[model samples]
Target: MKVHFIAIGGSAMHNLAIALHKKGFEVTGSDDVLFEPSASRLGKYGILPAQTGWLPEKITPQLDAVILGMHARVDNPELLKAQELGIKIYSYPDYIYEQSKDKNRVVIGGSHGKTTITSMILHALQQAGKNFDYLVGAQLEGFDTMVKLTQEAPVIIIEGDEYLASPIDRRPKFHIYKADVGVISGIAWDHINVFPTFDNYIDQFRIFAETIQPGGELIYSETDEVLKTMVDGLSVDVNKLPYSLPEYTIYNGITSVLYSGKSYPLQIFGQHNLLNMEAARLVCQNLGIGQADFYTYLQTFKGAARRLEVVGKNDNATIFKDFAHSPSKLTATIQAVKSQFPNRPLIACIELHTFSSLNKEFLDEYAGTMDAADEAIVFIDRKTFGQKKIEPYPAEVVKNAFANERLLFFNEPALLLNHLEQLNIANSNLLMMSSGNFGGINLIELKNILL
Candidate 1:
């Protein structure tokens, strides 16, 4: 098959393109611009575009299909050309479903923890030598790409995101997967620009739950009241399996899970991760992985990239970075680090990089979220406002929105770093959280200073 991608430089799109190329399909793609990792990975596979920018002439009818990306606008020239020629177009998830409809699809869904849960399942499956394909949000240690599609794998594990599929397809991506085994870790309102309202945002998950394949199993977090009430109230034909936080102990900064009277020590620790581990264990059970084997493989499951990932650590101090900016994620991450090591002084700093995180209305959602941190700091790079085309607000506005008088705010990277340098870091843990680069602040370099 011959596939051409429009706006192929996207994080998900590039991975799918590479997967198809590896699957023996003749793949070609175009993008307005490309960046590191995506650009270099595509170039290595001999699929990078000759030049940046759309070329409508490349969208000939000879192409078997055009995979559209959310990065491309509806009026994109290549898209218009494909439409004019009557060539079939597919959002990546739509095509992925078309390819995997015959296989067992296990989709992990939630506002948070889906990536970690999906990564855990993949790690276990890989260790057990199970034949499976997967699509996880973050890069894993053993995985080369975020997406994998194959003709022989009997099952496909998907991290089902509730975001728009493409510029033309407004339907949440999860609604298209029609999961045979669905997992909802939890739900917290996010994507302020997309949903506009909390109720509207949650309605997407409701729709997702209703779409699970008939007779399939739904493994959800029973601890999450919203999910528990929603899943139980539904009258779907699938088996409703509920899971909560498992029995675990944190000793000397190491966590161990007690199951069947046996203790399984783990390399990762956190309340949310323990919950995610339970969700993953249930999914692996559905896939025929025995109970003992599940815990055995889980011991080696470190975690996904940027999800409480350690950047630097020493005997006394630890420096971590995470991709957490939403209200619930920020709260959970801060609380997790604090609860794990109650004795250690934690300096939790976050950068409001996303449009939702910086929006005035959404800022209020984060009230008291970071109170668990011994010292809470917020950073919003002044230039980020102009780059995102959003109006800038003062540091006082942020401090007031968080409703914490002790919160320190910074609009400059130097000031933030300088503040870190001033803190007494003997036996302290520093957690720097953001979805962006913290305004080009080199965190590893900062880790050097703190540790």
Candidate 2:
């Protein structure tokens, strides 16, 4: 098969392009701009475009398919050419769904926890020597790519994102999969720029649940009241499985899962992660894995990248960085770090980088989100407001929105770094949470300072 990708510089798009190349398909791709990792990786595979801009010549009648990335604009030149030639242009998710239509699709969806739950299931399956294709959002330690496609894998595990499928196709990505087995981790309003309203945001998940193949299983987190209600309203024909946080105890900053009067050590922790584990366990069981086998294999699992990732640690201090900008994610991450290190004073700093997080109205949703931390710090760049064309928020406004008297806010990364450096690291934990790098703050340098 000869395939070309529009906007191939995207994280998922580039990975999919590489996956297709490895599958022996004649792969070609184009993009307006390419960033570091994507450019380097694509170059390593000898597929990076010689020039950085899109070329209409890349899209031809001879092309078998053109996979469109969500980053591609509707008026993209290559896309326009493909449409003119009447070529089959599949959105990234659309292409994935088309490829796995005949297979049993296990889609892990929700506003959060999808990546972790999907990673957990994938790790377990790999450990059990089970062969399956998968598409997870974050790069797992043992996984070669975020996406894997094969003609022979009977089941395809998808980390179903609620974001739009493509520029032209505005439907949520998960809805495209038409899952045979579905999981909703939890629902919290996010991506305000896309959904606009909370009701509209939630309706997407409803569509996901209703779209599941008949007699298919729906595994979800019971701890989430919103998810529980949504699942309760689903048709009785759909198999419903609810999960909660597994039994566990934290001792001296290490969390262990308690099962059958025995405490099994775990590489991951947190109530949210514990809940994620239960959902993963149920899904794996549905996929023919027993409870004992799942637990046995999970012991060796570390975690997905940037999801409560430990960057540096010493005898008295540990620092973590997490991809947590949404309100629920921010709360869960802080709570996780604090739960694991109850005795340590946690200094949790989160960057307001995403469009949703930068909105004035959405700021109130973070009220008390950082209450779990011993010292909560928030960072937002003034330049971000300029780039986003949103009104600049004063630290007072942020502090008021959070409703935390002790919460400190910084508009500058250097000042934030200075404040953090002044902190006494003895018996203290630092957690930097953001979907971005906080104006390109060097975490490795920060870790070096801590050490």
Candidate 2 residue lDDT tens string, 1-451: 9999999999899989988888899999998899988999999999999998989998989999999999888899999999999999899999999888999999999999999999999999999999899899888988888889999999999999999999999999999999999999999999999999998998999999998999999998888898888788776458898888787888876788888777778989899898999999999999999887788899999999999999999898999999999999988888888778878899999999999999998999999999888889999987899989998968899999998989999998889888877777778999999988888789999788777
After TM-score superposition, the amount by which residue 426's alpha carbon in candidate 1 deviates from its true location, in angstroms, is: 1.7
The sequence of per-residue lDDT tens digits that candidate 1 reaches over residues 135-197 is 988889999999999999999999999999999999999999999999999989888789999
The window of 10 residues in a row where model 1 has the poorest summed lDDT is 417-426
Please, what is the whole-model Cα lDDT of each candidate in the order they appear? 0.91, 0.90
Candidate 1 residues lying further than 4 Å off, grouped into runs, are none
Worst 10 residues of 2 by lDDT: 229-238
Error of 1 at 338 (Å): 0.9
Q: Count the backbone clashes (under 3 Å) in each candidate.
A: 0, 0
**Judged by lDDT against the true structure, how good is candidate 2?**
0.90
